[model samples]
Target: MTPDEYAAALDAERSARNDRARYVVCEEHGAHALMRRNGSGQAWGVARHVSQETAELAAAFLNRLKEDEA
Candidate 1:
């Protein structure tokens, strides 16, 4: 492949690794956490949404983010 195309592919791989999210449960505490990568590419807990409304809002926020999905 061309140099520019190879660089673009490498960047895509890095960005895909950096931009992602997931949810996890703490069985003992019965708690939920929203984990995501921030602009600085650091994985952090966005919040421990304690209420249904807050949880839905967080979901909406993620949906609205629209990060040029491939």
Candidate 2:
């Protein structure tokens, strides 16, 4: 995914959930958004620095992060 794709996913997730507390974009890990609930936390991965090759993978990892929070 490119930067545009990452941005779109972020928008979608934000619209769907209202529990997110922060968004972190890491050079090493790409775009990561954090969600907190009941004092607990979760993270969702976006694209890897706007790169298409790693975007989907990062997104998948992020989805797992959300599940872990659950």
Candidate 3:
């Protein structure tokens, strides 16, 4: 997805009350990374990679991460 599309999706996910945490696919230094915001609202990369495949994997990982935390 385009950067704007990613941003919209991230915003929507973050706003959803059911979502225990938010995951974002963002560009950094010409590459994409999966990020999550800390309790302090600072974005940090959970996984960094240059491929969309890795981003998809990161999304799945985020789901499991939430479940584990619960």
For each candidate, what is the lDDT? 0.56, 0.50, 0.74
lDDT of 1 by residue, 1-70 (tens): 9999999998898577545543322212454555554456566665676665566567566745544343
TM-score of each: 0.35, 0.29, 0.51
TM-score: which candidate is best? Answer: 3
Task: Please report, as a residue range, the 10-residue window in candidate 2 with the lowest summed lDDT.
Answer: 30-39
Error of 2 at 36 (Å): 15
Models ranked on lDDT: 3, 1, 2
Worst 10 residues of 3 by lDDT: 13-22
Per-residue lDDT tens digits for candidate 2, residues 1-70, read: 9999999998777655534433344445444333223325555443345554354455456656765554
Q: In model 1, where do residues sit more than 4 Å from their true spots? A: 1-28, 37-44, 66-70
Model 2 ranges off by over 4 Å:
1-50
At residue 64, candidate 1 shows an lDDT of: 55
